[model samples]
Target: MDHVNISVANNEEKGANVDFDYSQRAQWLRAAVLGANDGLVSVASLMMGVGAVKQDVKAMFLIGFAGLVAGACSMAIGEFVSVYSQLDIEVAQMKRDHITNHDQELAEKENLPSPFQAALASALAFSLGAIVPLLAAMFIDSYKVRLAVILAAVSIALVVFGAVGAVLGGSSRVKSCVRVLVGGWLAMAITFGLTKLIGSSGLQM
Candidate 1:
Protein backbone atom coordinates (compact mmCIF):
# COMPACT_ATOMS: atom_id res chain seq x y z
CA MET A 1 0.00 0.00 0.00
CA ASP A 2 2.88 2.39 0.76
CA HIS A 3 4.56 1.63 -2.57
CA VAL A 4 1.25 2.17 -4.32
CA ASN A 5 0.82 5.53 -2.63
CA ILE A 6 4.36 6.59 -3.55
CA SER A 7 3.77 5.62 -7.16
CA VAL A 8 0.58 7.63 -7.20
CA ALA A 9 2.33 10.63 -5.71
CA ASN A 10 5.05 10.48 -8.35
CA ASN A 11 2.47 10.30 -11.09
CA GLU A 12 0.66 13.26 -9.68
CA GLU A 13 3.85 15.30 -9.63
CA LYS A 14 4.62 14.36 -13.19
CA GLY A 15 1.13 15.27 -14.27
CA ALA A 16 1.36 18.61 -12.57
CA ASN A 17 4.62 19.35 -14.38
CA VAL A 18 3.10 18.43 -17.68
CA ASP A 19 0.00 20.47 -17.11
CA PHE A 20 1.64 23.73 -18.08
CA ASP A 21 0.52 25.03 -21.46
CA TYR A 22 3.22 26.68 -23.53
CA SER A 23 0.55 28.65 -25.33
CA GLN A 24 -0.15 30.44 -22.12
CA ARG A 25 3.26 32.11 -22.48
CA ALA A 26 2.37 33.52 -25.87
CA GLN A 27 2.44 37.08 -24.66
CA TRP A 28 6.15 37.02 -23.91
CA LEU A 29 6.83 35.26 -27.17
CA ARG A 30 5.00 37.95 -29.04
CA ALA A 31 6.77 40.73 -27.21
CA ALA A 32 10.15 39.18 -27.91
CA VAL A 33 9.37 38.64 -31.58
CA LEU A 34 8.10 42.15 -32.05
CA GLY A 35 11.18 43.59 -30.35
CA ALA A 36 13.50 41.52 -32.52
CA ASN A 37 11.63 42.34 -35.70
CA ASP A 38 11.60 46.04 -34.91
CA GLY A 39 15.28 46.01 -34.01
CA LEU A 40 16.28 44.24 -37.19
CA VAL A 41 14.23 46.30 -39.61
CA SER A 42 14.70 49.66 -37.95
CA VAL A 43 18.46 49.35 -37.55
CA ALA A 44 18.85 47.86 -41.00
CA SER A 45 16.80 50.68 -42.47
CA LEU A 46 18.72 53.27 -40.52
CA MET A 47 22.04 51.84 -41.64
CA MET A 48 20.89 51.82 -45.25
CA GLY A 49 19.60 55.36 -45.04
CA VAL A 50 22.80 56.63 -43.54
CA GLY A 51 24.77 54.65 -46.07
CA ALA A 52 22.79 56.23 -48.85
CA VAL A 53 23.63 59.72 -47.74
CA LYS A 54 27.08 59.25 -46.17
CA GLN A 55 29.05 56.05 -46.33
CA ASP A 56 31.56 57.09 -43.73
CA VAL A 57 32.02 53.96 -41.66
CA LYS A 58 32.18 56.01 -38.49
CA ALA A 59 29.00 57.91 -39.30
CA MET A 60 27.08 54.78 -40.13
CA PHE A 61 28.34 53.07 -37.01
CA LEU A 62 27.34 55.98 -34.83
CA ILE A 63 23.88 56.13 -36.29
CA GLY A 64 23.42 52.39 -35.95
CA PHE A 65 24.54 52.51 -32.33
CA ALA A 66 22.21 55.34 -31.58
CA GLY A 67 19.34 53.55 -33.22
CA LEU A 68 19.99 50.35 -31.31
CA VAL A 69 20.11 52.17 -27.99
CA ALA A 70 17.03 54.21 -28.72
CA GLY A 71 15.07 51.34 -30.15
CA ALA A 72 15.89 48.99 -27.29
CA CYS A 73 14.97 51.57 -24.70
CA SER A 74 11.77 52.37 -26.51
CA MET A 75 10.87 48.71 -26.86
CA ALA A 76 11.49 48.04 -23.17
CA ILE A 77 9.41 50.94 -21.93
CA GLY A 78 6.65 50.43 -24.43
CA GLU A 79 6.41 46.72 -23.80
CA PHE A 80 6.31 47.23 -20.04
CA VAL A 81 3.57 49.80 -20.28
CA SER A 82 1.57 47.79 -22.75
CA VAL A 83 1.91 44.50 -20.94
CA TYR A 84 1.17 46.10 -17.60
CA SER A 85 -1.98 47.64 -19.01
CA GLN A 86 -3.06 44.31 -20.44
CA LEU A 87 -2.40 42.56 -17.17
CA ASP A 88 -4.39 45.20 -15.36
CA ILE A 89 -7.29 44.68 -17.72
CA GLU A 90 -7.07 40.95 -17.29
CA VAL A 91 -7.11 41.33 -13.55
CA ALA A 92 -10.10 43.63 -13.77
CA GLN A 93 -11.85 41.17 -16.00
CA MET A 94 -11.20 38.44 -13.49
CA LYS A 95 -12.62 40.56 -10.70
CA ARG A 96 -15.68 41.32 -12.76
CA ASP A 97 -16.09 37.65 -13.63
CA HIS A 98 -15.84 36.63 -10.01
CA ILE A 99 -18.03 39.37 -8.63
CA THR A 100 -20.76 39.42 -11.23
CA ASN A 101 -20.76 35.97 -12.75
CA HIS A 102 -19.33 34.07 -9.77
CA ASP A 103 -17.22 32.04 -12.15
CA GLN A 104 -14.33 31.09 -9.88
CA GLU A 105 -12.75 28.92 -12.53
CA LEU A 106 -12.65 31.71 -15.04
CA ALA A 107 -11.22 34.12 -12.52
CA GLU A 108 -8.67 31.66 -11.27
CA LYS A 109 -7.36 30.70 -14.69
CA GLU A 110 -5.06 33.67 -14.99
CA ASN A 111 -1.93 32.58 -16.79
CA LEU A 112 -0.71 35.96 -17.78
CA PRO A 113 2.95 36.91 -17.88
CA SER A 114 4.52 39.44 -15.56
CA PRO A 115 5.11 42.88 -16.96
CA PHE A 116 8.80 42.83 -15.96
CA GLN A 117 9.37 39.52 -17.71
CA ALA A 118 7.81 40.79 -20.90
CA ALA A 119 9.76 44.01 -20.81
CA LEU A 120 13.08 42.31 -20.14
CA ALA A 121 12.46 39.81 -22.90
CA SER A 122 11.68 42.56 -25.37
CA ALA A 123 14.74 44.61 -24.49
CA LEU A 124 17.10 41.66 -24.65
CA ALA A 125 15.65 40.39 -27.92
CA PHE A 126 15.91 43.81 -29.48
CA SER A 127 19.51 44.15 -28.40
CA LEU A 128 20.35 40.73 -29.81
CA GLY A 129 18.70 41.47 -33.14
CA ALA A 130 20.27 44.90 -33.44
CA ILE A 131 23.73 43.45 -32.81
CA VAL A 132 23.52 41.24 -35.86
CA PRO A 133 23.67 44.05 -38.41
CA LEU A 134 26.19 45.93 -36.38
CA LEU A 135 28.52 42.94 -36.21
CA ALA A 136 27.95 42.01 -39.86
CA ALA A 137 28.98 45.41 -41.12
CA MET A 138 31.59 46.09 -38.45
CA PHE A 139 34.69 45.12 -40.40
CA ILE A 140 33.64 45.92 -43.95
CA ASP A 141 35.31 49.07 -45.25
CA SER A 142 33.55 49.42 -48.59
CA TYR A 143 30.15 51.14 -48.27
CA LYS A 144 28.44 48.94 -50.85
CA VAL A 145 29.87 45.80 -49.34
CA ARG A 146 28.79 46.84 -45.87
CA LEU A 147 25.30 47.62 -47.05
CA ALA A 148 25.04 44.32 -48.89
CA VAL A 149 26.26 42.40 -45.88
CA ILE A 150 23.86 44.23 -43.57
CA LEU A 151 20.97 43.40 -45.89
CA ALA A 152 21.89 39.74 -46.06
CA ALA A 153 22.32 39.51 -42.30
CA VAL A 154 19.08 41.32 -41.60
CA SER A 155 17.15 39.14 -44.06
CA ILE A 156 18.39 35.94 -42.52
CA ALA A 157 17.66 37.14 -38.98
CA LEU A 158 14.17 38.33 -39.88
CA VAL A 159 13.32 35.03 -41.53
CA VAL A 160 14.54 33.08 -38.53
CA PHE A 161 12.65 35.28 -36.07
CA GLY A 162 9.45 35.08 -38.09
CA ALA A 163 9.66 31.33 -38.47
CA VAL A 164 10.27 30.85 -34.77
CA GLY A 165 7.42 33.14 -33.82
CA ALA A 166 5.11 31.33 -36.23
CA VAL A 167 6.06 27.91 -34.97
CA LEU A 168 5.55 28.99 -31.38
CA GLY A 169 2.20 30.63 -32.22
CA GLY A 170 1.08 27.57 -34.21
CA SER A 171 0.85 29.54 -37.42
CA SER A 172 2.21 28.94 -40.94
CA ARG A 173 5.97 29.21 -40.68
CA VAL A 174 6.75 29.73 -44.32
CA LYS A 175 4.13 32.40 -44.74
CA SER A 176 5.26 34.23 -41.66
CA CYS A 177 8.88 34.19 -42.76
CA VAL A 178 8.04 35.42 -46.22
CA ARG A 179 5.87 38.18 -44.83
CA VAL A 180 8.56 39.39 -42.46
CA LEU A 181 11.22 39.17 -45.16
CA VAL A 182 9.17 41.23 -47.55
CA GLY A 183 8.32 43.80 -44.91
CA GLY A 184 11.95 44.18 -43.92
CA TRP A 185 13.00 44.62 -47.51
CA LEU A 186 10.33 47.22 -48.07
CA ALA A 187 11.45 49.20 -45.05
CA MET A 188 15.09 49.23 -46.08
CA ALA A 189 14.31 49.97 -49.68
CA ILE A 190 12.07 52.86 -48.80
CA THR A 191 14.51 54.36 -46.34
CA PHE A 192 17.44 53.99 -48.70
CA GLY A 193 15.52 55.44 -51.62
CA LEU A 194 14.29 58.42 -49.68
CA THR A 195 17.72 59.17 -48.32
CA LYS A 196 19.31 59.00 -51.73
CA LEU A 197 16.59 61.11 -53.26
CA ILE A 198 16.78 63.74 -50.59
CA GLY A 199 20.56 63.73 -50.54
CA SER A 200 20.75 64.22 -54.27
CA SER A 201 18.34 67.11 -53.98
CA GLY A 202 20.66 68.96 -51.55
CA LEU A 203 19.10 67.71 -48.29
CA GLN A 204 21.85 65.28 -47.50
CA MET A 205 21.95 63.93 -43.94
Candidate 2:
Protein backbone atom coordinates (compact mmCIF):
# COMPACT_ATOMS: atom_id res chain seq x y z
CA MET A 1 0.00 0.00 0.00
CA ASP A 2 2.79 2.44 0.91
CA HIS A 3 4.62 1.60 -2.29
CA VAL A 4 1.52 2.17 -4.38
CA ASN A 5 0.95 5.51 -2.65
CA ILE A 6 4.52 6.54 -3.31
CA SER A 7 4.23 5.64 -6.96
CA VAL A 8 1.05 7.63 -7.31
CA ALA A 9 2.64 10.65 -5.69
CA ASN A 10 5.62 10.39 -8.03
CA ASN A 11 3.30 10.22 -11.00
CA GLU A 12 1.49 13.32 -9.85
CA GLU A 13 4.77 15.17 -9.43
CA LYS A 14 5.85 14.18 -12.94
CA GLY A 15 2.56 15.36 -14.32
CA ALA A 16 2.96 18.70 -12.61
CA ASN A 17 6.45 19.08 -14.03
CA VAL A 18 5.19 18.28 -17.52
CA ASP A 19 2.47 20.86 -17.18
CA PHE A 20 4.96 23.51 -16.11
CA ASP A 21 7.28 22.74 -18.99
CA TYR A 22 4.42 22.80 -21.47
CA SER A 23 3.27 26.18 -20.20
CA GLN A 24 6.74 27.63 -20.57
CA ARG A 25 7.03 26.25 -24.10
CA ALA A 26 3.66 27.76 -24.97
CA GLN A 27 4.75 31.19 -23.78
CA TRP A 28 7.93 31.01 -25.89
CA LEU A 29 5.98 29.88 -28.95
CA ARG A 30 3.51 32.73 -28.54
CA ALA A 31 6.26 35.33 -28.39
CA ALA A 32 8.15 33.83 -31.31
CA VAL A 33 5.03 33.66 -33.48
CA LEU A 34 4.11 37.28 -32.79
CA GLY A 35 7.61 38.54 -33.45
CA ALA A 36 7.97 36.51 -36.64
CA ASN A 37 4.60 37.63 -37.95
CA ASP A 38 5.46 41.26 -37.38
CA GLY A 39 8.81 40.91 -39.10
CA LEU A 40 7.45 38.96 -42.07
CA VAL A 41 4.55 41.33 -42.66
CA SER A 42 6.59 44.51 -42.21
CA VAL A 43 9.49 43.47 -44.43
CA ALA A 44 7.27 41.87 -47.07
CA SER A 45 5.07 44.94 -47.27
CA LEU A 46 8.06 47.24 -47.48
CA MET A 47 9.49 45.22 -50.33
CA MET A 48 6.14 45.05 -52.09
CA GLY A 49 5.74 48.79 -51.78
CA VAL A 50 9.13 49.38 -53.32
CA GLY A 51 8.53 46.77 -56.02
CA ALA A 52 5.47 48.72 -57.08
CA VAL A 53 7.58 51.76 -57.91
CA LYS A 54 10.86 50.12 -58.90
CA GLN A 55 11.54 46.89 -60.75
CA ASP A 56 15.24 47.10 -59.96
CA VAL A 57 16.32 43.97 -58.12
CA LYS A 58 18.95 45.95 -56.29
CA ALA A 59 16.31 48.35 -55.01
CA MET A 60 14.15 45.60 -53.64
CA PHE A 61 17.10 43.87 -51.99
CA LEU A 62 18.22 47.08 -50.37
CA ILE A 63 14.77 47.81 -48.99
CA GLY A 64 14.25 44.31 -47.69
CA PHE A 65 17.69 44.23 -46.03
CA ALA A 66 17.05 47.60 -44.44
CA GLY A 67 13.71 46.48 -43.14
CA LEU A 68 15.14 43.27 -41.66
CA VAL A 69 17.95 45.03 -39.85
CA ALA A 70 15.82 47.88 -38.58
CA GLY A 71 12.95 45.66 -37.56
CA ALA A 72 15.17 43.22 -35.69
CA CYS A 73 16.85 45.98 -33.75
CA SER A 74 13.52 47.56 -32.94
CA MET A 75 12.07 44.29 -31.74
CA ALA A 76 15.09 43.55 -29.56
CA ILE A 77 15.07 46.94 -27.89
CA GLY A 78 11.32 46.92 -27.36
CA GLU A 79 11.29 43.44 -25.90
CA PHE A 80 14.23 44.19 -23.62
CA VAL A 81 12.62 47.31 -22.22
CA SER A 82 9.22 45.72 -21.78
CA VAL A 83 10.50 42.57 -20.13
CA TYR A 84 12.82 44.53 -17.86
CA SER A 85 9.94 46.68 -16.73
CA GLN A 86 7.87 43.60 -15.96
CA LEU A 87 10.77 42.09 -14.08
CA ASP A 88 11.15 45.22 -11.99
CA ILE A 89 7.46 45.23 -11.17
CA GLU A 90 7.49 41.60 -10.17
CA VAL A 91 10.56 42.03 -8.00
CA ALA A 92 9.01 44.98 -6.24
CA GLN A 93 5.89 42.97 -5.60
CA MET A 94 7.92 40.11 -4.21
CA LYS A 95 9.60 42.50 -1.84
CA ARG A 96 6.25 43.84 -0.79
CA ASP A 97 5.15 40.32 -0.07
CA HIS A 98 8.20 39.93 2.17
CA ILE A 99 9.47 36.75 0.65
CA THR A 100 12.45 36.37 2.94
CA ASN A 101 13.30 32.75 2.34
CA HIS A 102 16.48 32.64 0.29
CA ASP A 103 15.61 29.46 -1.55
CA GLN A 104 12.14 30.72 -2.36
CA GLU A 105 13.55 34.04 -3.53
CA LEU A 106 16.06 32.29 -5.74
CA ALA A 107 13.33 30.13 -7.23
CA GLU A 108 11.18 33.17 -7.94
CA LYS A 109 14.05 34.94 -9.62
CA GLU A 110 14.76 31.87 -11.71
CA ASN A 111 11.17 31.84 -12.88
CA LEU A 112 11.16 35.55 -13.68
CA PRO A 113 11.47 36.74 -17.26
CA SER A 114 15.00 37.39 -18.49
CA PRO A 115 15.34 40.61 -20.44
CA PHE A 116 18.39 39.43 -22.37
CA GLN A 117 16.78 36.16 -23.35
CA ALA A 118 13.61 37.87 -24.45
CA ALA A 119 15.55 40.39 -26.51
CA LEU A 120 17.60 37.75 -28.26
CA ALA A 121 14.58 35.63 -28.98
CA SER A 122 12.66 38.55 -30.43
CA ALA A 123 15.49 39.65 -32.68
CA LEU A 124 16.20 36.15 -33.92
CA ALA A 125 12.57 35.40 -34.62
CA PHE A 126 12.14 38.64 -36.56
CA SER A 127 15.17 37.99 -38.70
CA LEU A 128 14.06 34.43 -39.38
CA GLY A 129 10.68 35.63 -40.63
CA ALA A 130 12.10 38.51 -42.66
CA ILE A 131 14.46 36.21 -44.53
CA VAL A 132 11.65 34.47 -46.36
CA PRO A 133 10.71 37.34 -48.66
CA LEU A 134 14.33 38.34 -49.22
CA LEU A 135 15.32 34.88 -50.35
CA ALA A 136 12.28 34.56 -52.56
CA ALA A 137 13.24 37.64 -54.54
CA MET A 138 16.97 36.99 -54.48
CA PHE A 139 17.56 34.91 -57.64
CA ILE A 140 14.48 35.91 -59.62
CA ASP A 141 15.29 38.41 -62.37
CA SER A 142 11.81 38.89 -63.74
CA TYR A 143 10.04 41.75 -61.99
CA LYS A 144 6.59 40.21 -62.00
CA VAL A 145 7.83 36.80 -61.00
CA ARG A 146 9.85 38.29 -58.14
CA LEU A 147 6.83 40.01 -56.69
CA ALA A 148 4.66 36.94 -57.10
CA VAL A 149 7.23 34.72 -55.42
CA ILE A 150 7.58 37.12 -52.52
CA LEU A 151 3.85 37.28 -52.03
CA ALA A 152 3.56 33.53 -52.18
CA ALA A 153 6.40 32.96 -49.74
CA VAL A 154 5.08 35.50 -47.29
CA SER A 155 1.59 33.99 -47.48
CA ILE A 156 2.89 30.49 -46.81
CA ALA A 157 5.00 31.65 -43.87
CA LEU A 158 2.11 33.57 -42.37
CA VAL A 159 -0.08 30.50 -42.53
CA VAL A 160 2.58 28.32 -40.92
CA PHE A 161 3.14 30.81 -38.15
CA GLY A 162 -0.57 31.15 -37.52
CA ALA A 163 -1.12 27.41 -37.39
CA VAL A 164 1.75 26.88 -34.99
CA GLY A 165 0.54 29.68 -32.77
CA ALA A 166 -2.97 28.25 -32.71
CA VAL A 167 -1.73 24.80 -31.83
CA LEU A 168 0.43 26.06 -29.01
CA GLY A 169 -2.21 28.51 -27.77
CA GLY A 170 -5.04 26.03 -28.07
CA SER A 171 -7.01 28.28 -30.40
CA SER A 172 -8.89 27.56 -33.63
CA ARG A 173 -6.28 26.78 -36.32
CA VAL A 174 -8.52 27.83 -39.21
CA LYS A 175 -9.43 31.13 -37.60
CA SER A 176 -5.88 31.92 -36.66
CA CYS A 177 -4.57 31.05 -40.12
CA VAL A 178 -7.28 33.03 -41.87
CA ARG A 179 -6.80 36.06 -39.68
CA VAL A 180 -3.05 36.08 -40.17
CA LEU A 181 -3.28 35.45 -43.91
CA VAL A 182 -5.83 38.21 -44.44
CA GLY A 183 -3.92 40.66 -42.35
CA GLY A 184 -0.67 39.98 -44.23
CA TRP A 185 -2.39 40.28 -47.60
CA LEU A 186 -4.01 43.54 -46.58
CA ALA A 187 -0.76 45.01 -45.39
CA MET A 188 1.10 44.09 -48.57
CA ALA A 189 -1.77 45.17 -50.81
CA ILE A 190 -2.27 48.52 -49.13
CA THR A 191 1.42 49.33 -49.15
CA PHE A 192 1.82 48.32 -52.79
CA GLY A 193 -1.30 50.16 -53.94
CA LEU A 194 -0.51 53.36 -52.12
CA THR A 195 3.10 53.35 -53.21
CA LYS A 196 2.08 52.69 -56.79
CA LEU A 197 -0.48 55.50 -56.64
CA ILE A 198 1.96 57.95 -55.14
CA GLY A 199 4.67 57.00 -57.63
CA SER A 200 2.26 57.54 -60.48
CA SER A 201 1.21 60.92 -59.07
CA GLY A 202 4.43 62.64 -60.18
CA LEU A 203 6.15 61.88 -56.91
CA GLN A 204 9.91 61.44 -57.21
CA MET A 205 11.79 58.55 -55.51
Clashing pairs in 2: none
lDDT (Cα, tens digit) per residue for candidate 1, span 31-51 = 889989999899889989989
For each candidate in the order shown, give its overall lDDT on alpha carbons: 0.87, 0.92
How far does residue 180 in candidate 1 sit from its true spot (Å)? 0.6
Q: Against the true structure, candidate 1 has what lDDT?
A: 0.87
- Highest TM-score: which candidate? 2
TM-score of every candidate: 0.82, 0.90
Q: Which stretches of candidate 1 lie over 4 Å from their true place?
A: 1-22, 98-110
Weakest ten-residue segment in model 2 by summed lDDT: 22-31
Candidate 2 — which residues are off by over 4 angstroms?
1-22
Could you tell me the lDDT of residue 117 within candidate 2? Answer: 84
